[model samples]
Every structure is written in structure tokens, then in C-alpha cells.
Target: MCSHYEGPTADRIHHAFGIRPDGPVQTDLWPGHRGYYLTSGGDSGGLSVSTGTFGLLPHWAKDVKLARRTYNCRSETAAEKPSFRAAWRQARHCIIPAEAIYEPDWRSGKSTPTRITRRDGGLILIAGLWESWSDAEGLQVNSYTMLTINADQHDLMRHYHRPEDEKRMVVMLASGAIQDWLTVPAGESAAFLRQYPAERLQAEATG
Candidate 1:
């Protein structure tokens, strides 16, 4: 699962996805961190970029620590996990635009930071589910969690994280399918939950 990413500015996001920003954009986002998420704008065929935490916070969560663990939901079980079922069922889909995603690579007998990006050097659109949670003060906190699909067989992604751990990769949506991902029928969303081919991706170990 991705714990951090480099996102674009609001203007760049607006131009790239036609999503109007509802708040300021966050260039750097990490789990339990706040950022801008682009959600569908209904029949208008537009999008709304709103400030939301990077981690999902179910309405029932009492502590913020849970946000860390809920940052990534298994696409295969998102519909069944209590923390993500509501958002998945309600089709509260969103997209997280990222310049690069930082993960740990443990292939060298030691863990090292690794950055993953499109081979074309363009921003990646990651599919996610968002939800709204309110605190005692009635503060509405909207948050999101990336959906991950098994990637054990992926040529590049499988190299990240610990070798002993099951490999997984974030669901990436193609530029042409951005709107489709945000508005796909709930029952059919599973069709988009698959590994992005490694040939179009690039990765480097960061010192």
C-alpha cells in the first residue's frame, strides 16, 4: 500500500481532470494526511475537488489511529470490509492524482524508499473510495482510501515491499476512463480493479 504521494496543484488538477477545487490543494499527502480528492459532479459530467484526509475514517471510528490501517482497502474485499463497505456500496468513488507514489523496496536485504511513476512521466490517476465522518463538534471530515488489487504477478510492482509479504498495487485508471471509474455502476466497478501493466510504468530506489 502507498503511504505517501506527490500530488499536483489545484490549477493543474482542474486543467487535467476538469475538477473544480472546493479548497486548496495539498502537494504532499500521506496516510492520515489531508489532500484534495476529485469526485464526480453527477449528471453535469464534471468533477468536484474537495479537501479530504488521505485515509478513510469510518463514521464509527473513535480514534484517528485507525486511519493509518484503513489507508488501503483490498479491492477484492472492499465491499465486505466494515470500514469500506458503505463507501463502496454507495459508489462514493474518487480519483487521486499523483506525480509519484513512494513505497518501500526490500529486495536488497535492506529496506529502501522507492518511487513509482508512469513511464511517460505523467500524473497517475489512482482509484479510491471516499466517505464523510463527523466529530463531536459537528465537524464534517471527508476522507478517502485507495483500493488495492493483488499484484503478486506484476513484473515491477511485485518488487516493492518485503518479499515475504503478499504483493499489491493501487488500482490505476486510464485517462480516458477517469469519468467511467467515478461513475461506473457499483456492481460493475470490479471490472476496473486490476493491475496496471508494468511495461508502461517506471520505478527507482531512492537513497
Candidate 2:
């Protein structure tokens, strides 16, 4: 359940080692990449979409406003869902840049927000899939969702809370793994769909 994120880099500064506000809404609001949207909400946590602006394209979708609800695609069934199946097969691949990602620790009495970042201050390339939806106006919009995998021993035992019921986090790919992740066959990529080692990541409590 990734919702909040932050990006404070120049729009033209593509592929830097920091979070950048680029994606569907940025394209709609700023017009650039046809696929991807950046979210800095505490819940969305800065994601990259695969489509143009809006997330889904109904067979009868008549307006772009419908997109506001289709921002996320569940990883468990994404490959089987009609809405995401096609994109998952051919039109997938996006880089969700983030400086840090937040997760809640409920046991702390208050909902303690922890900021998880790379130890060396590098960007975390969250794996994503995109889709293109067209409205009655023939305007195409792209959107995306991050994939999640079960938490590893490190994230479950250290970075995240213990007794973690639904221990899950976005599938963050390393910089060196991004190229293979983006171009590999979907079936083969599933092997790469695992939690990043918690040792290489650090989580700091945030205000």
C-alpha cells in the first residue's frame, strides 16, 4: 500500500540518483512522458505508472476523470486481470524514483513513520507497470502501480515491525538491476521480484 512520496529535482534532470516528480500527472500537468506519474502522498510514496495519464481504460470509458480511481494495480493478480494483463505482457516497465519511502509502525503507540532510504543515498528504482487509457475525446492517459513482494527477514525483523501480519513493501530494484528489470521477459522477471535485502537499506523514523 504505497501512497506517499517526494520529489524535488528539476524536470529535465532525468535519471539522477534522487527522487524526481515525473509521471502521468506530471505529464498531464506538464506534458512529457506518456507513461508514468509521481505521487508524494504519505500513502502513495512516489510511484511510476506505465500508461499516459489516467490509469485504466474501460471498454466504455468516456472521460478521463474515471482514472483517478485506477491508480493502483494489485501485484498478486496483475498478470491475470484484464485491465493489467495486456500491459503486463508488452507495455510494462517504469522507474519510480524515490529518495525515501515511509512505512508505519503501529506498535509504537503512535503511527511512527519510518523513512527507508539507500545507505549510499542512491535512488530506489521501484518496479512498475503502465497502461494507456483513452477517453471519448481520444485523449490518451498513462498510469502505473508498484509491485510488492513478501518482506524479507531483514525488513521483517529490523526495518519493519515484528509480528508483522502482512509484511509487504514495494519491489525496489537496485540501480545495477534496473536495465535487466526493464527489458527482461515477464516470465523470467518474476525471479527478480523479491524484496531488496534489508541490510542495503536503512530506515529512519521521520516526524
Candidate 3:
């Protein structure tokens, strides 16, 4: 599962969002850090961007630390997992705009951070789930997690992670299909969980 990434700049995001989020956009993101997520505004027929913690914060969560382990939700079990079930049932899907994602490559008997980006040099619009939580003062807080599918047989993504671990990659949404993914009924989510076509991505060792 991915834990680090480079996010799009505020200007780049503004072009897509029509406005920038309130503060500075984070360039490097990790679990528990702040980042931006896009959600479908109920009646606007458009996306609304919001800055929130990178990890998903379920209503029952006592603190934001849960984000560390909840950064990447496994697609196979997301609907049944406690940490992600509510968002799944609510169909709180979102797209995380990333410049690139960093993952560990363990090919040489050692771990080296590898950078993965789209071959076309466009933003990698990662599929995710977002949830809102209420703090002690009743203030609303938002958080999110990326959705991942098994990538063991993928030509590019399969090379990531340790050999002993199951390889997985985040689901990437195409621009044309973004609206469909955001508004589709929960039962149809499986249709959007497909692995991006092989070789549509490129990777290089960043460390």
C-alpha cells in the first residue's frame, strides 16, 4: 500500500477546482498529514475541494492517529472492514490528485523509494473515500483514504512492495469517468475498481 506522494500544486488544483483550497497545498503527503480531497457538491454538479487530514476519520474514531493505518483501504475488503465500511455504504468516493506516489522497491535485497507517475505526465487522479467526523466542540473535520486493488499481475505496479507482501496499487480514475465514479450508485462501484491498463504508468527509483 502507498504511504507517500507528491500532490498537485494549488495552481494546478485551481484549474481543476475553479478555486484553490484555503491554505498552502502540501507537496509531500504521508499518513496523518494534511492534504486535499475532492467531493461532489450535492447540487452544483461540480466538485468541491477541501483540505483535510490524509487518513480517514470515522465518526467513532477518538483521534486522528488512526489515519496512519487507514491510509490505504483494500478494495477487496473495504465494504466489510470496520474502518472503511461506513464510507463504503455511504458511497463517499473522492479523487485525490497526485503528481506522483512514492513506494518502496525491494528488488535488490534492499528497499529504495520509487516514484510512480503517469506516462502522459498528467496528474494521477487516485480514487479514494472521504468521511466527516465531529470533534468535541462539534466542529466538523474531514479525512480520506485511497482505495487500492491487488496489483500482483500488473506490469508496472506489481514490482512495488516487498516480495513477502501482497502487491497493490491505487485505483486511478480517468477524467471522463470521474463524474460517473463520483455519482454512481454504491452497488456499481465494482465497475470502477479496475486496475489501470498495463504500462500506462512509468516508474523510476527516487532514492
Candidate 4:
């Protein structure tokens, strides 16, 4: 599974694509940070990462902090888990615009990182889901999670090796698949989602 990502050009491309660019975050030792946000039905908000927390605000949520830890959702059971089922069924779908994503190689013990990007150098429309939660202060928090699918045998898999890794990779939507993925009725089988070809991605090992 991917635990780190890069969104260097998120802001520049979001507007060009008619989407919103949330905000960026800076980690003490990380190379760089960027942000991405989304809006729907006249509601708008963006995502921000601070202290390693990624904050997302959805139209339905009253607070945005809830997204701090919900950045990833497992595809194997996302449709069955309480935290994700409802969003997966009803309020489903989000766009995570990223230039590239980072993956670690544990075998080297030196944290060898891999940068995965689209072969075409375009923004990757990562599949995600949004949800709203309420805090004690009555503030609503909006959060999101990136969905994962089983990774195909490839050079990238050499680095990710958790017994529970499940060999998963995030679901990178095809240009035309976004609208359909967002509007498809709930309870529908996700078979079509698994149909995307895996050859569209390219990954390289980096420092």
C-alpha cells in the first residue's frame, strides 16, 4: 500500500482542470508539500496537511479535521466498513489530484523511496470518498480516504512488503471513469472498477 505521495503541481493543474487546489503542508524533513481540495453543489473546500495530518472538508461535514487520519481506505472491505460504507454507497466519490505518489522500500533499511507517476505526466485522478463527522463543539469535520486495489505484479511491488500489505495499489481512475464512478448507484458491484488496465502507470525508484 502507498503511504506517502507528492502533489507538487496540484494547485496549478486543479484550476486548469476546473477544480480547486486546497493548500499545502510542510514536514520538517520532507522534500516538499502541496494541497488539493474539492467542491460540489455550491459547496467548496480544500485539503491541508499539517503535522502529518491531512485535513479535508466535504460539503456535508461541519468540521474538516476528521480527515486527518482517514486518508486511506481499504478496497477489499471499504463497502462493508462503517467508517466507509455509507460514503461508499451514498456520498461516494472524490478527486485526489496528485503529480506523483511515494512508496518506501524497507529491504534497504535506508528508506529507498519510489516515485510513481502517470506515464503521460498528467494529473492522476485518484479515486476517493468523502464523509462528514461532528465534534463536541458542534463543528463538522469532513474527511476522505483513497481506495486501494490489489497491485499487479510489477517492479513497484519489490519495495512494499507488509504481511498485510495485500499487495494493494490505489485506484487511479481513467479520464472517463470519474463521472461514472461518482454517479453509479449504491449497492452496485465494483466489478467495473477492477476493469481498469494496469499498464497506464510508470514507477521509478528515487532517493
Candidate 5:
């Protein structure tokens, strides 16, 4: 799962997606932390950038600990899973703009941190789902989770994680697909759920 990533700045987001931010800009973001995501700006017919908890918090959830496991939604089961069904059904989709995503490489019999970025050295927009839930204080708070798909066939992604574990990769959108990603209906959105080609990605071990 992608628990941490380098978030794009608000200005960068506007330049890339033409979405005016609705809140403060953030940089480094991790699960349970706050960050910005781009979604369809309801009524305005344009993209809207807004802050949300990196981990998802379903409206019916009573424990924030649920967030620990909800940061990443399996693309195959998102529509059927209790944790993500609501957002998936409502088509509450968003794009998580990131500079890089960190993963663990255990090929050396020990874990090594690896940073994955675009070969073009540009932002990577990951497909995600978002939901708004009321906190204990009765305030409506927003949260989101990235959507991931199997990557066992991927050349680069398969090299990460333990050899015994099934490989997974987040759904990264192409520069031209951001608009369709945010507006596509839920029933027709499955086409967007797939691993990015390793040829377009670069991964390196980080000290």
C-alpha cells in the first residue's frame, strides 16, 4: 500500500489540473495526515482541489483506527467492500497528485526503501476515492484512499515487497486522463483500474 507520498503544491495543482484549491497547501503527506486531492467541482463544472485525510474514515465508522487499514482500497473489491462501497457507488472519485511514492524492496533479504517516480520527472496522478464523514464534534471532515490493483505482472513493481507477497500497484492516471477520471460514472470506471507500465516509471533504492 502507498502509505506515504510527496504531495504537489496548490499552485502546482492548479497549473497541472486547473483546480483552484479549497484549503491550505500541503507537501509531504502520510496516512492519517492531511493533504489535497482534485475532484469534480460540483455545480462549477471544473476541478476543485480540497484537503482530506490521507486515510479513509467512513461515515459509519466509530473508530479512527479503521483508517489505518483504509488508506488503500483494492481496486477489484472497492465496489463490494464495506469500507469503500459508499464512495465507489457514489462515484466520489479524485486524483491524488504525487511527486513520488515510496515502497519497500526486500530482494536483498532485508527491507530497503525505494522511491518510484515518473520517467518523465513529472507528477503522478493516482486514482482515489473520497468520502466526507462527521467527526465526534459533528463537523464534516473529508478523507480519501488510493485505489490499487494487482501488479504481479509488472516488471518494476514486482521487484518490490517480499518475494512471497502478491505484488500490488496504485492506479496511476495519464496526463490526458485526469478529466475523465474525475467525471466517469462508477459503473464505467473499471477501465481506469490498472497498473501503469513499468517502462514509464523509474524506481531506485533510497538510503
Candidate 6:
């Protein structure tokens, strides 16, 4: 599963998605950090950009730190996981735009950082769920997590991670289907959990 990525800048988002963020955007993101996500059915009733903590903070969480361990939710078990069930059941869908994603390459018998991106040089739009948590004083905090699917057989994805572990990759949406993924009916959103074609992606070891 993906826990690190090269996030897009506000200007890149405006150019690729046609939506401008309300404030400065974070470009480097990891668990427990702040980043931007897009949703369709917010207070605006249209596509809107929002800033949220990278790790999902469930309603039952006593503190915002819960995000650290809740950043990557497996799609196969999200419906039953305590940290993700509510968001998954409520269809709190979102799209996380990134310039690239980082994964570990272990083919050399040692873990080396690798960067994965589209061969076309377009944005990598990842599928995710969003949550809104309120504290005792009514302070609201938004958080999100990337969803992952099994990638054991994927030509490109299977190359990363450890050979002894199950291979998995983050769920991604085709650039043309961004709106459809965010607006799909509940219980049916799972249709978009399919893998992105490996032929369109490229990877390289990074220092």
C-alpha cells in the first residue's frame, strides 16, 4: 500500500483539474500530514478542493494523532474496519491528486526508494475516502486515506515491495472519470476500485 507520494502544487491542480484551492497547498505528503483532496457533494454542491490531514481521523478517535496509523485503508476490508467503516458506508468519496507515488524496490536484496508516475506525464488521481471529525469544543477536522487493492499480478506494481509480502497498489481513477468516481451512488462506488493499466505507468529507482 502507498503511504508516501509527491503531491501536486496548487498551480498544477488548477491546470489539471480546473479547480483552484482556497489556500496554499502542501506538495509533500505522508501519513499525519496535511494535503488536498477533491469531493463532489460538499456544502458547495459541486466539485470543491479541501485541505485535510493525510491520515483519516475517525469520529471515535480521541485525538487527531489517530491519523498516523489510519492513512492507508485496504479496499477489501474498509467496510468492516473500525477506522474506515463509517466513511466507506457513507460514501465519503474523494480523489487525491499526486504528481507521483513512492514505493520500495527490493529486487537488489536491499530496499531502495522508487518513484512511479504516468508515462503520459499526467496527474495520478488516487481513489480515497474522506471523514470529518469534531472535537469536544466543536472544532471540525477533515482527514482522508488512500484506498488500496491487491496488485499481486500487476506487471508493474508487482516489482515493488517485498517478494515475501502480498503486493498491493493504491486504487486510482482515470483522469477522465474523476467526476464519475466522486458522484457514483453508494454501494456501487466499489466498481471503481479496479486497477489502472500497467502499460500506462513507468517506474525508476530514486536516490
Highest TM-score model number: 3
Candidates' C-alpha lDDT: 0.86, 0.57, 0.89, 0.57, 0.88, 0.90
TM-score of each: 0.95, 0.70, 0.96, 0.71, 0.94, 0.95
Please give the lDDT score at residue 47 for candidate 2.
32
Model 2 stretches with alpha carbons more than 4 Å out = 15-72, 156-165
Off by over 4 Å in 5: 20-25
lDDT of 4 by residue, 31-142 (tens): 1122443323223333322122243334444344445445677777877876677777685566665678777656665566777778887767777776655666876545
Question: Which one wins by lDDT: 1 or 5?
Answer: 5
Instruction: Report the candidate with higher lDDT, 2 versus 6.
Output: 6
Tens-digit lDDT string for candidate 6 (1-207)? 888998988898888878888888567788888899999855656578899999999999998888889999999999999999999998899999899999999999999999999999998999999999997799999999999999999999998889899999999889778888888876898899998999999998896
TM-score of 6: 0.95
Best candidate per lDDT, number? Answer: 6
lDDT of 3 at 17: 61
Q: TM-score: which is higher, 1 or 2?
A: 1
- Candidate 5 — what's its lDDT? 0.88
| Residue pairs with backbone overlap in model 6 | none
lDDT of 5 by residue, 85-201 (tens): 999999999998899999999989999989999999889999999999997889888899999999899888998888899899899999888889999999988999977889999
Per-prediction backbone clash count: 0, 27, 0, 5, 0, 0
lDDT of 2: 0.57
* Cα displacement (Å) at residue 77, model 1: 1.0
Candidate order, lDDT descending: 6, 3, 5, 1, 2, 4
lDDT of 2 at 184: 65
| lDDT at residue 93 of model 4 (Cα atoms) | 66
> Residue 56 of candidate 3: its Cα lDDT?
91
Kindly provide the TM-score of model 4 when superposed on the true structure, using C-alpha atoms. Answer: 0.71
Pick out the ten consecutive residues of candidate 2 with the lowest summed lDDT: 24-33
